[model samples]
Structures are given as structure tokens and as C-alpha cells.
Target: MRRALPLPLGLLAALGTPLPSLAAPSVELGQVLITDEAQDELIDAGERLRETPGASNLVDMQRVGQGRVASNQDVLAYQPGVFAQSAGNDGIKLSIRGSGINRAPGAHGSGVYTMFDGLPLTGPGGTPYELFEPLWLSRAELLRGANGFDQGSLALGGAINYVTHTGYDAAPLQVRYEAGSRGYQRRHVSSGQVLGNLDYYVALTDAEYDGYQKHSSGSAKGFAANVGYRFNPNLETRFYLRYRETENELAGRLTKAQIKHHPRAANAAYLARDDSRPQPGSTWVGNKTTFFLDDDSRLEAGLVYHDFPMDLREGPMRLKVAYTDVSGTLNYLRRDTLFGHQSKTTLGWRTTKHLPNSGASQFVRNGDEFGPRSRDFSYQGSDTVLHAGNDLELAPDLWLTTGLAMIYTRRESAVSYPADGGKVSLHDWDYAPRLGLRYDIAPQLQVYGNLSRSVEPPHPWSLIWSSTVATQPIELENQTATTLELGARGDSVLGRWDLAWYYAQVRHELLAVEIVAGLPAKEANASPTVHQGIEAGLDSTLWERPGNGKLSLRQAYTFSDFHYRDDDRFGDNRLPGIPMHYYQGELRYDWPSGFYAGVNTQIASKVQVDYANSYHADAYALLGARLGWDSPKQDWQTWLDLRNLTDKRYAATVTPGYDDAGQDVARSTPGEGFAAYLGVSYSLR
Candidate 1:
């Protein structure tokens, strides 16, 4: 075989794929060998998302802090197409692919499009999860659909940035603690530094729990900070701050026979209406700047400010909302040589607005006393975007991607209380476009394809809370999709892999039901819906023993298939609230003296809950474990986390129901049983 030659046509279609990592690395003996590492910003963002052609994910909070990193369901555990569940506190229920499937699980969170260090934090009355602390992350980036079109996110679940911690990765001082089971605890502290061209970071956190149903207790507090400067070698700037506060106590949904025999029971009209939710604080501030315009061009700018407020005491209504927002961004980047190959470009613009005192003020409660002010509203909105993108190097490793976007929207709702009460204004314009292709076919294989479009709109308090006739306001539309994707990523001998498949064609699709039964959940507009999927991932190391310990495995899988393409009474049936098969896994062991151990699993698939598919919510499996230590100069760390051992009794989430004509009724949110956790951290580098 000393005479091998000829191969192209995308490396002969990746050697006729039969799926061996996807179907398909190392260097030595040279003084020049570098894969990635500029102080490792998550391996330079996984080498800049492998030059994205479609689909992307990267989350690292230093291996998720070894374990027990609380909320956002432990920082999106095992990610692969994401689902994120937890309704027993830090409000979870996120979705991707089937985008905001049936929206429920704490206040607003819909069709994903959030960001922090990369600017904007979703506005127009949605995506508010008490400042999302997550230990003030150091990484998290997901691009997904339309590959986020250079970050001006066209919704339908795309774009999530969340990157904090500065001072080049932070570690000047730190402290941490955690405790668990049904009465958990957590606290943390931090600091960071760097001097010459300035830099800084800060953090603080708090938590409390006493929940596993019955009144489902909760509490939280937070803080985060940042600063940066560089004023030379092409300029730079940064600034940010955050604040938060929260309180929760509302345990209402349940029944699959109360999650198979009273799995922590608590709904009897929520114990005669004692439900709660309190949040008197939430804030964010931001800034970003950069400029180079030389070594191949660059420019960037951003600004943001946000405030969130709410105090809905749960049922007999005592609302008290008010929000504020403002945002702006600009970007430009370039690298050229087009005709003869090698090019890259991006241009963007963004906007968000809502102010003029944003909305709400209803009131009327009974046993806990509160009367006057029955209604008064006001909520306006705005969103603007303009985008452009390009990449080309069309042969020799092949790459081509293109994009376009244009959007402008405005929504206004008004009901200056008990008088005439009605006003709705709207304005719109939309467009999105993209195309892609990628092929490396060597360098451990890569392949990709895409075609996209996405759009979503309808918040502004969901047009008077999904109105039926409560002061008018209800005409919702604008939710579109048009996707198609194919993907692959590799590294053979069974080591690393990622695979994807997608198909969508949704046109009005905005679902959400729960007709009535203790409030909330009413969104609409659904007619032609179909969203298909499959996403797979693996990261294995199987075994190794050079200095005495190694074995690893990681996995994730998702396969949803939302329905309805023939509906006039639920004809094709199926679209009810995720779960068409989902899985997660982890198995690990590592020691070269840093110590580690793990075992984990999660499986789901039996979730219909209603849309005339007449109730469902059974299948489940969960088990977990972890043990850890890291001190090989990592300064200090510790962990031991376990959950739902064999005490299964599941149903982690579901907030559906439009026709429970078959009645088993309540609506589910149980999942949590045998738990344990412990953690510690110390640093000073």
C-alpha cells in the first residue's frame, strides 16, 4: 500500500460511510505541534465551532465543576439537542429543536434566544429566569438552527451564549460549598485579577431548598461582575454586572396516580391556595467594544440594560409585573481573498426595546387579603435585526456558507384598566435565509449540510395572556420554520462523534394548552406542524492504563417527532409535550491522582399528556452517581453527588392539556427522589 493516491469527491464520500465514529489524530517528532490552547477558552471555542455549517454546542464550566452545579438543570446536563427539565425550583423546561414545546415551568421562557456576555438577554416579555446564575459560567455557546446566523439569532431555539469570568479564566481567589437532599444549601464567593491592561471578575451566589413537592420551597440570590480594558494592540473594552433574587413555592400539578403513589404529593388546590412566587429583583447591565480594522478587519459594539419584576402570588391572581429593556449591537468582521479562495465575512445589527413602563398590575386575592386594582395593562415591544454572512474556500477541504436576515417587529397591547379597555397595535416585516455545506473529510472527518429559515413572535404577555375575552387582544400569528439539515463529525477507533438529522416545516405552530385548571398555559396558533429530529453524540475512551487509571464514556440521544398536519380535531395526533425518546449516559473513572468516578443515566419516552391523544406520562428511568477530587495543582475541589438512585417514580415535566377528555388530569412534574450532594471548592492560583 506504499502507493496510495487519488481521493476527493469529498474524500470519496467519506470512504463510503458505514458509520464508524461517524463513518471514519496526533502529532509528534516536531518542535511545532499545537492543536489548541490560547489559555484554553474551551479549546478556543472548539476551534471556533469547527467553522460551523450547522449545529453546534460547547459548554464547559471546567467539566461542569465535577458535579452538582445546581440549576439550568445542572448546566444542561448531557446536552445533545437539549431538553433541560426541573420544575422544582430554578425553573427549567428549556427545549431546542421542538423549540418551546408547550411552554410552562416558571414565568417566561419561549423559543430560545438568550445571551449574556455576548449581549442581549431576550426581551419583549420572555426568557426571564432570575438572572440565570449557574455559578456565573465561563462557557456555554450553542448555535443550532440556522447556525444562529452570526449571532443575530432568528429564534426557533438558536443561540445561547452565557460566557462570564474574565481575567483570562479567573482564579485569584474563590470559595464554595453545597449540601443536599430535600433541604439543600449552597453558597459561593469569588474574585479574579490581572493588572497591566486591566481585567477583573467577581461572583457571589446563594441558595436554599426544602422541596421535593409539598409546598416546594425555594430561595436564591446572586451577583456577578466583570471589567476589562486593553486600549492598545487594536483596542478593546468590556463591562457588565448582574443582580438577582428569587423565591418560589408552588407545587400544583401531579397525577399519574399522583406520580405512581403519592410521589411527594401536594396539590389539593395547592393546599387550599397557598401558592407563591416572589421576585423583587433582577437586573443586568452591559457594554462591549472592540476595533481593529487592520489585520483583516474587525469592529464590534454592544450595550444592554434590563430589569425584570414579577410577584404573582400564584392563583387567585395578584399579579404585579413591570419590565424594562434596551439593547443594541453592531458587528463586522472580514478576512478576504475571495476569487482565489479563502474568505470569511459577517455583518450584523441587533435591537430590542420595551420601556415606557412595560406592563401589568392586576390584583384580587382572598384569604391572604388583597383587593383593589383589578386590571391595568401596558406592554409594548420591538425587535430589529439585519444580518449578512459568508464563508468560502470552496474546494480543497470544501466550505461554503451564506446567509441573510432582515426582521423588524413591534407589538403593543393596552388596556388602561376598566375603561373601554382595548388596544392592540402591530407592525411586522420578516425574512431569513441561509445555505450551507462543509467537508473536511480528513483531519478526523467532518461533513455537513443545511438549509434554513426561522421566525417567532407573540409575547408582549402573549397578547393579554392568551386571551379568550378578557379585555380583547388576541390575534397571534408569526411562528415559522423551514429547516433541513444533515451532519457528521468524527474521530475513529470509537472515540468522539456527533451526528445529526433534522426536518421541519412548521407554519404557525405556537401551541401551549391547559385550558383551565388553576391557570396559566394558553398560547395558540397551530395548523401545520411537523418537526423531525435525531441528534447523537458520544465521547469515549474506553480504557487506558499508562499511569494507572482511565475509562470514560459519554452519550446523548434525542429523537422527537412533533405532529399534526391534518387537524380539525386532532387527526394525526402526537404533538403534546416532548419525549419521543430521549437518553443520556455517563460512565467514567479517571485517576492519575486527581481522582474521579461516575455513573449516570436518564431515559424517557411516554409523554403525551393530551391534545386528544388522551393522556400519557409513564416511561422513565434515572440513576446517578459521582465522586470527585481534583488537586493536581488545580488548587482544590471536591464532589459527591447522587440523585434518584433507584427511587425512580418519574415525570420530570409536562405542562400540556387541551382536551383531557379521558381525564387522569393534574399535569405532572414529579421526578426527584433519592438525592444526595456535597461539594467544596477553593482556589488561589
Candidate 2:
């Protein structure tokens, strides 16, 4: 048990002490009073200042609560270059810098990485990252590109850090239930408490939706819990756990003819082949557990374990060290997929041979143990990766972060028929070194830059399975890149603004190429490629009236050109699916009484979807509105939010392929529209 400091002393002590005033030379003040408590406050403030060194965006808890983000991807959509595509709740696909858009069968890799309280939640198969429920998070910080070295893990794109709520203060309880269009409904319950030296928060959310396409209805349920204890003011420990289960029967790719017939028509055959669930009736489960320790505000350590099991797909095992204040982290991951098949028959082949059965019987019994060619087979494989690194602060303004990661992978797949047997195993290695610097130009402004290296491992789909084919594990060639960036961030009348420019050159880059429908052409490390971009953002209040009202604005924009240097297959083609431009804007008005209204808008330019640059997805925009009241004098709060106010038709997915009828077989799902939600909450302080 820990003692709670007296109210006034506790807060003041955490802020710092007031210096003694100098008295007249002749009549010096009797001894200036400086309490022991004041000394502790100074130390706390000093530690906090040293722990975090960079500008960060902290979304208001209230604003987050009002936004109905179905998945972690949704949480990133408003940010430049970040987008999440979900057929429905729990079925989410995310892309950052155009990664993961072209996931082929059997491959396990997603470029972006995610962590909670400094614990990586990314899986070995990589495609299916555990969709962290934002409800349990206190706040999140995004460190774009290599600037995210503090996350302790290795990622080339960027890092999303979710920090769970903890520490002393008040206890709050909130429960919300909302229903909307498309048969969408959800319920969330969350609570937080600070007792003695321990603090914690927990939340649970259950959501269901009857999607835009027939047979696409589904339900998603999840639970997340966090617990932390402060061992005096210098030591603390915390635990985070999450579990999610989802069932979806959804439509997949469709030919242009099918789309022309009816955009929302149900293609049962296509629906049955949803890649995420090969079987018509299937379920997917994901679980994550992480433990972390914080010491003296200068050292942090964490361990994370994740499991993703499915009824019809491979399951992956992932572990990581996502936290570090002094030294960095090490990560290890393994993934495997296995299935069982069985065949049964009542009649024997001998009967068919002796009795001279009908033509149908003869044809059916031709190859048999019950039937000619009756076969049952399954395949299994494992991918192992070990990544270790550290962020070393060599000087006050200069820091060097470096690490090495190695991966060993194996595949043993068999068809019951001895005629077809194959095995493949390969080892791959990558060394990453990162250097970053920040020079304070002034007390209010700073200049920063970084150069780093990264790699993307091969996916399971890269293995060949044809009996006649001398199948081979695609040669493991490390995909490496060098990045150079410069940025400036500070506070001003424009509110808080961040501007940056970056240029990256990559060798042996992994680029996805669409060979034909439902099949991969091959895996290859292409010629050098390059990506250059500029990112800018602003957040601030435009006007404010004392005790009356205020108007605020928030905006972000990204401009980039990502392309392959030269290639025969897709010569000088701009990498597909990554838009050249994207933007987000929000306007809000708040009254003294807690009444508020806001409008949020998001836009993305047209993007190519294939290596040949033959297919494209149209540009789109979405708008949302919110009305709420949070009274300062009351403990209760209520709000209403409406999304996709226009009910506009939009596409969320598109595949690059021509159908049997010689028509484009690309299918796009419409974004939800005119959806509204209402909820009320109360807290006891």
C-alpha cells in the first residue's frame, strides 16, 4: 500500500518549487521557507522533462470518445498517409506508405508496426495485426518514419504508440451504447481507478453490423484490461491484455459485369471464398498479453506475446520488447499453419470392379480406396525471426540507434499421394543502423534529422507447390533502404505546427505484382526504388471569447511520389495504391456551458492499383458532424455523432485483374453513410 500525499502538496510538488525572493540588503527576510516537499516536486519535474524530448500529438480523451473508429486503422485514417479498410468491425486492413495493400496468399508481412504501452502487438504472419481497441487507451502518439526509434523495435514506415491510462488522480466509470445505419450497433464499458500506489483501466466492446453487401453481416467482440502499480515515485509495473473474436460471411472480388449488374448484389460463390475466411462459416481469434516495468523514469522494459488463430488460415506467434529508456529491445516471432482433411466412403472398389456397376459408379470408383484419387492432405510451416537493438544517447542533442535482425524460415508441405512431396527452409539476415539529431535553435524551436535502414521478410505465399515444378523458397534477399529526413516543430499563433521533408532510396525492394486472378506470378526483389515526400500539420484555436465560446481548427496534409527506378515488368511505374496527395481538416465550436459542434472532413486522391498501372481507384471524400454537451458543474455527459452525412457511394477495396468474361474483376465496397450514434456517460470523482 502507498500513502496518498495531501492534495495541494501532491500537485504542487509535481510541478516544482518557487525560488526564494531576495530581501533588501539591510533587512534580509528571516530564513526563506523551503519545505522538504518542495524538493521532491523539483525532482519530479526534472525527470519528466528529461524523459520525453520531441513534439507529440495528444488527442483529447473526450474527442476520441466521440469518434466511432471501428478499428485501430480508423484511429490512423485521419492522419496523413494512414488509412484502414474494414469490410466491417474486426475485419480490418491497414496501409501506411502503401504497404500491405497487395497481400498475396501465404505471405506474412505488413510494413507498419503497432505497440501498446511500448509492447509490440504485431504478429509473425504480419498481415493480421491485432486490431487494438482504442477504448482501453488513454492516448496515442505517432512517431512517423525513423523518428520512432524510441519505440525500441525495428520498423521502416513508422510507429504507433498507445499509452494506457495510469497513475494517481480520480476514478471514473463510463458506459456507452450506440446504434446506427447498416444495422451497426455497439456497446462499450470502461472504468479507471487510482488506489493507493496502483492505477489501472479496463474496457470491453461488442459490435455487430449488417454490412452493405449481402451475406456480409458480422459481429466483433473484444475485451481489454490494464493494471499498473507505482512502487514509490521511482518504480512502476503494468500489465496489458486484449482478446478479440469475430465472425464474418462476406463477399469478395467481383468481375466488372457483376458490378455493372448490381453494385450491391450478393455473389454467393465469391462470398464463400473470402480470403480471410476460406470456408463459408468461419471465425478468427486474436489475443495479446504484455507486461512492462518502469524504473526511475530513465529505464523501461517490456515483454509481449501475441497469438492469432483462425478456423481456416495459418496462426502466428509473436513476441517483442517494445519499451526502453536506456537500452533498446529484442524481438522474436514464429508463425505456422496446419490443417486436417478426411475422406470416407461406404462401398469398396472391389464391388465396383466385379459387379460392372453403372457408368456413374465406374467413373466414381476409378481410383480407389473408396474412390479413384480420393485424397486428403495438409501442409505446415514455420517462420522464425529474432530482432535486437538499442537507442544510445551519445550526446545531449545527438543520438544513435542501431540493431540487427535475423530470420530463419522453413516449410514442409505434403499431399497424401507420395507423388507430391516438398520441403523448403531458408535463412535471412538484416542489419539496421539509425542515427538522429535534434539541435535546439531556440527555447521554442528545434531542428531534427535522421537516417536509418530497414527490411521486409518474405511471405509464405512465395513458396511454390506444383508437383511438376521444382518449387523453391524464394531466395531471401534482404530488402534494405536508406532514409534522410529533416523537420521543424514549434508552437505559435498557428497553434502547434510540424513540417518535414524526406527522401528515401531502397535496394532490393519488395514490390507486389499481380500475375493473374487469385494467384501470384512470382516473388522478386526489384531494381532500386525511391520515395520522396513532404508532410505538414497544424492544430489551434482561431478565436475565443472569455467565458463564452471558442472556435478551433486542425489540419494535416501529405504529398509524395513513390516509384520504382526502372523495371521491365512495371517500368518506372509509380508504386500502386499510394496516393500522391491526401488531407484532413476539422472545425469546431465550443461554448462555455460545454455545448459543442464540429465538422470533420477527409480526402484522398486517385491511386493506381497494379504494377502495370492499368487499374485505378477513384478519389473520395467523407464528412462527419458531432454535437455534445459536457457540463463543468455536472458529472454526466451526452453526445451525438453522424458520419458520412451525404450517404455518398464509395469504394473501399479494389483488386487488379480481368474476369473470365474479359472484364475487370475489381470490386469496391461503399463507405457507410448517414450513420448516427447517441450515448450518455457519467463519472464519480
RMSD of 1: 25.1
TM-score of each: 0.34, 0.73
Model 2: per-residue lDDT, tens digit, 1-685? 1122222112112111222221110110111122233234333432322223222233323356654656664555445445556644454555555455554322344666566665655433344533456666644556556545444434556666665554332236667776777787888877777777767677778887787666667777777777777676655667766677666654554444454455565554444434233212211222222223232113344554444444331111111111101112332221122122111111100000001110110111211112243222233333333444443444454434344444443333333332443444444444556655555444444556767766565543344322334332334355667888876655554454555677888787655554544433355676888877766665556898898888877676767667777766566777664556777777888887778889988776766666666656667788988888875744666778887788655555553332123335453444554678776766555
Whole-model lDDT, candidate 1? Answer: 0.81
lDDT of 1 by residue, 450-494 (tens): 898988888877888888777887778779898988887766565
List residue ranges in candidate 2 displaced over 4 A.
1-61, 104-109, 166-172, 231-235, 254-263, 266-268, 272-299, 313-420, 460-473, 518-524, 655-663
What global local distance difference test value does model 2 have? 0.51
The lDDT values for all models are: 0.81, 0.51
